[model samples]
Target: MIKVIKPGIQLTIQDLGRVGFRHLGVSRSGSLDTYAHIIANRLVNNHDNDAVLELTVGLCELQFECDTVIALHGADLKATLDGHPLYPGWSYPIKAMQTLKFATGRGGSRAYIAVKGGIECPEVMGSKSTDLGAAIGGFNGRALQSDDIIKITPYAQPWLYNKGALTPPKRKVIRLHQGPHHELLTPECINAFCTTSFTINPNSNRMGVRLDHNNSQIMQHSLSLHSLAVAPGSVQLPPDGNPIVLLNDAQTTGGYPLIGHVIEADLHQFAQFRTADSITFEFVTLEQATAAKSKLDAHLSQLKLSLNRYWAN
Candidate 1:
């Protein structure tokens, strides 16, 4: 068991989220950064789908109740375990009653914590992800609070993982895939969208990461139409001209004119961006997008095989 001392700006338990309930207006409320979540699980020898703790904006404090192995990934939140600095993407043996703390991180906006057997919670709609908008699933369907005790399921399987941490690549240019709605943007606006350095808005949240393009003309070019299917990374230009990238908790459909979709390979990097971060966008061909996704998959597979390899005694 783990006890929450300070729950940070936002603390929630998440898995990969619900599989296919978007037709009913369900939002995918899983970890904002999926790659980091998987890596954290790997460090702890947990399954990819295990429920883990997602800390947004850091400043969290947790106390362990028993000896266990754990891992951390995503944001460099300046975390410390029992007064020793904790590194991301590495596993550590946690002693009973040891306290773990996180400060406001400078690099990214979100962080993930994974334990050996994962967090125990009633799965709702076949998911343990917390949908804060709907208030269903994960620790009574709400964000974790101070004094809440999280139960951890015990796993006794013998496994091996590297003691060293994986270094994540940093990216500034966001890759996008053109959708049919790309035609909605005027040719001038299209160039502006790609050329301009958009700043991440302070109002960004799980629902969407709003971008400040600093140009109002982009918003006037689009007219409202029927609501179309929207998913994570859908770049929508509303009346304000600022483009909002839909994320895990966004609605399944939206009327906002979409300029493009962020490639799957870039979602993890984009999720780590914080307010005021400058990001330039470039649209890529479908072939390029497929190749990028394949690259990420190949990397994950190699990492998994290396970690699960047998070690000769």
Candidate 2:
């Protein structure tokens, strides 16, 4: 078992997410940084779909009730285990009663924690991911709180230790594809959207990230848009003339004008962005977007093969 000493700004259990229910208005609420979540699980010999803890704006504290092996990945959370600094992307053994603490670090906005057998949380709708908006999954369907005891499997497994952490791309350029309503934007606005850099606003969250174009708001010819289906990565231009990028917990439908959709390959990096982070947008064709996804898949496959070889030793 693991106990939450401090829940930090926001902490919740997540898996790949609740899939195939979007048609019914259920959002695919899961870890904002999917790449980190998968890497943490892989390091601990856990399946990619296993439930893990997602820490947003780390300052979390946790204690182990039994001997276990675990892995930490994503943002440099400045995590320490038993007073010793812990590194990301490596599995470590923990003794019973050991305490682990984390502080906010640079480079990213979230972190992920994975145990050997994954977090043993009750699954809802075939997922362990927390849906904060609907309050339907994860631990009590809400953010973790102090004194919350999370169940951990009592099994051990072979995992690589002292492995090198994968370096995530730090490029601020995000590639996107034309959205359904891309035509609504004026020609000048389109040029500005593609060329200008935007800073993330403090209002960003799992639902959506509101962007500030440095006071140069993006304007569209149409002020009103009909409500339509939206998903994670959808970039909507609201009436306020600022673009909002919908995220994991965003509503299924939005009324704002859709200007573009960030490609899936960039979603992980996009999720790590925090307030004041500057990002530039570039448009890509569907072919380019599909190729990018293929490249990501190839990398993941290679990583899995390497981990399997290491475990066999």
Candidate 3:
């Protein structure tokens, strides 16, 4: 068990998110950076979909109530255990009554903390993710507050010390595939969209990230489109010409024009991008997107296999 000392800016429990519930109008609210979330769990020898705490903008603090293994991943967040610096991608053995704290780190906006056996939270809609919009899951379906108690499984495999995995490359260039409403965009609009760099707007949240097109227009001119189904990573162009990259917690459907969609493998990178970060889009073929996802899947599979061996021994 652990108690929240400071709840950071926006700390919440998340798994891989709600699955197969979009039809009921529920967004898949989960960790924004799935790569980090899964890696954190992997280091702790937990299942890939185990629930962990997602901390945004750092500044969270927690005190452990029992001995357990823990791991950190995603954004650095400059985490420390009992005043000792802790690095990401590696597991640590934390003693009872020890305190862990985090400070803002460079490069990313979110970090993930995973405890052995995962967080013991109630599953809502087959998932332990928090849906802030619906307020239906996670710890009472809201951001964690100070003094809140989070329970952990008492029994867990012994902590195994191992070197962390290599960090993923920081690619500010996001690869995108033409979206369903690609036809609505004129050639000049498409050129401008891909050629110009955009800054992530401060108003972004879990639902979507608003991008300022650096004074460039998203479309050469206005073209209205009817409402259509959308998924995470869908890049929609609203009336104001700013592009919004819909994320895990985004609405199921949207009326704006779909210009492009970020590939699944790269969504983690997109999620880690912080406010004011500069980004540019590059178009990719379907085959290229498939290959990238396959590569990442293979890497994760191997990492899981490595961690499994440690636990099995």
Candidate 4:
């Protein structure tokens, strides 16, 4: 069991998210950084879809009721267990009554915490991810609060740990793929979109990220289109002309005009973007996006293979 003494900026339970219900106007609510969440789970030898805690801006404090192995990943939040620093991408064992604390993040916006065998919560609509808009899944379908007792399942497998920690690669440029409506944009507008740098807005969340552009007039001529299916990392331009990148909990459909979609492999990088951080989008071909995704999948597969080998020995 885990006791929440502090809930941080915003902490909630998340997994791969509930899928295939968008036709009914439900959002695909899940972890904003799918890659990091899955990596954290794998580091603890838990199922990739197992429920884990997603902490935004850190500052979460919890106490363990029993000996448990946990893994930390995603953002660098300067987490420590019982006053000892904890590293991302590595699993560490915690004794009973030990306290865990996470300081404010220095480089990222969110962090993932995975315990052995995952957190046991009542699943809703086939997932444990919190859908804040509709108030479903997670701990009563909302961000965690003080005094909440989260049940942790007993670890069935043997206790195992990873020796090394994995950190995300530093990303300065965000890559984008032109959408079907890219041709609808004027040549001048497209040029400005690529040339200018944008800062992430403080109002960003799992639903979408608001980007601050150098000049809003560049999107003055952009027109709204019919509502279409939106996915994570889709850059949409609203009536205000500011670009909002949709995240995991974004609505399935949106009426805003799309500028482009960020490739899947790089979407997790955006999850770490802090307010005021600068980012420039570079357009890439469909082939390039596909190749990048394939490469990432291969790397994940190799990690799984290595994990199996280590456990076998």
Candidate 5:
């Protein structure tokens, strides 16, 4: 069990997210950084879909009430337990009443904390993820607050020491697939979209990330289209032509024109971008995107194998 002493900027429980309910007007609410969330859970021997604490911009403080193993991943927020620095991608033992705190993240936007048996939050729509816009799922369907007590479920497997800390692969350029309307735009506009660097706006959230391309003419362009089903990582261009990347908590449908879609394997890293951070996108063919995803799966399989080897010995 753990008690929330301070509920950072925005901390909530998240899992893989709810699905098969889009027809009911419900959006799939889940961890924005799905890769990090799954890795954190696997580090502690929890299922990949287990519920974990998703900390936005860090700044959370909590007290453990029992001995348990936990892992942190995603953003490097300079976290510490009882003043000692805690490393991500590694499991650590937390003694009873030990307090853990996370400072502001220096690089990424969100961090994930996974316990041994995952968080014991009630499942709504088949997931523990909190959807703030709809006020459903997670801890009472809202963000955690100070004085809230989060219960930790008992683990089925015994606590075991596994591999040492892990280092996430460096993100150089995000790969994007051409959209359905890629041919509609002029060659110069398309080239500008791919070559120019865009800054992440401060108004970014789970719903979507608004990007600033610094081109007034692009924003002046307008388009009209009927609303269509949208998915995570879909980069939509509004009437103003600026891109807004739909994220985990984005609406079920949108009328904006889609400019492109970020590759699935890189969406987690994209979710961790902070405001004003500049990012460049590189276009890739569908076959190339598939290969990239396959490579990512291979890497994760290797990590799992390493953990099993450590436990076997």
Candidate 6:
């Protein structure tokens, strides 16, 4: 069991989230940075979709009640274990009753910590992710609080020491594919979106990220459209003209014009965008998007395969 001494900005146990229940008005409320979440789990030899602790911002403090292995990834928040520096993309051993803490640092906005056996939480809708909007799954369906005890599920596999850091490139140019309403914006607006840099709004959250651009420089124009099915990474242009990138906990449907969709491998990059950070867009063909996703999938498969052999031995 791990006890939360201080649950920073937001801390929650999250897995890969619900896969087939989005039609019933459920958002995919999992880790915002899925790549980092899965990498942390992989480092600890856990399943890719195992529930791990998602720590947002910083200042989280956790104390281990038993000896276990843990891995952390995404957003280097300058974490420390017993006053020793612990970095993302690395796994470490914890002694019984040892403490871990985090401080504000440079990098992404969130980090994931995965224990060897994953977290023990009541699965809802076939997932163990925390849906703050719906108030189901994960530690009573909300951000963890101080003094919360998180139990780890039992595992019998022999512990293996795997040392490697998988770092996905931090890209300011996000790849996007044309959406159904891609033409809703005038050609000028589309050009401005792809060419100019937009700063992330402070109002952004797990649901979606609202972006801002200089009003005097770019035209704030978007044609109205009826509400339709929208999923994570759908870049919607509201009437006000600021683009909003839907994320893990975004609404099931949106009426705003869907200008583009962030490609799969690059979608997690948005999770690390800090307030006021600038990001540009790059329009990609469907073939390019497919190839990018396939490349990432193959890399993940190779990573898992390399570690599986060690564990099997």
Whole-model lDDT values for every prediction:
0.86, 0.86, 0.87, 0.85, 0.84, 0.88
Highest lDDT model number: 6
List CA RMSD, all candidates.
1.9, 1.5, 1.5, 1.7, 1.8, 1.8
Name the regions of candidate 4 deviating beyond 4 angstroms.
155-160
On the 0 to 100 scale, the lDDT of residue 185 in model 4 is 79
- Please give the distance, in angstroms, between residue 42's alpha carbon in candidate 3 and its true position after superposition: 1.2
Query: Model 1: which residue pairs collide?
Result: none
What stretches of model 1 exceed 4 Å from their correct place?
154-162, 310-313
TM-score of each: 0.95, 0.96, 0.96, 0.95, 0.95, 0.95
**Backbone Cα, N, C clashes tallied per candidate:** 0, 0, 0, 0, 0, 0
**lDDT score, residue 212, model 4?**
92
What candidate 6 gets wrong by more than 4 Å, as runs, is 154-160, 215-217
lDDT of 3 by residue, 1-313 (tens): 9999999999999999999988878899999888889888888768889999999989999999988888898888899999999988888898889999999977688988999899988899999999998997889999999999998975445555774865567788899899988886778788888888899899998999999865554454577777888999999987677899999889999999999999987888866788889999998999999998998888888887786776677
Candidate 5 Cα errors over 4 Å, as ranges = 154-162, 165-167
CA lDDT for candidate 6: 0.88
> What value does the lDDT take at residue 262 in candidate 3?
96
Please write out the lDDT profile of model 1 over residues 1-313, one tens digit for every residue.
9999999999999998887999999998898889899989887778999999999889899999977788999988999998899988888887779999999878888889999889999999999999999999898999999999999864444435446456457689989988667786788778878888899999989999988866657545646778989999898888677898999999999987888899999987767899999999999998999998898888788777777762322
Q: Look at candidate 4 and tell me the lDDT of residue 291.
A: 91
Model 4 lDDT tens row, 1-313 = 8999999999999988988888888888888888788888888778999999999999899999877888888887999988999878888888889999999867788899989889898888899999999999999989999999989965534465565446547576888988667888788788888888899999998898898987778766647588888888888877676789999888888887788999987888878999999998899988988998898787778778888777677
* For model 4, the run of ten residues with the poorest summed lDDT: 156-165
Candidate 2 residues 125-180, lDDT tens each?
89999999999889999999999999997654443365655845666999999988
Please list the residue runs of candidate 3 whose C-alpha ends up more than 4 Å from where it truly belongs after superposition. Answer: 155-158, 218-220
lDDT of 5 by residue, 1-313 (tens): 8999999999999999999998777888888888788789888878999999999998889999887889998888999999999977888877788999999866788889999889997888788889999999888889999999998964434556855545457574888988776776667677778887888889999888888887636544566778888888888877676789888889888887777899987787766889989888899988998998898888788888887777677
Over 14-35, each residue of candidate 6 has an lDDT whose tens digit, in order, gives: 9987889878998889988888
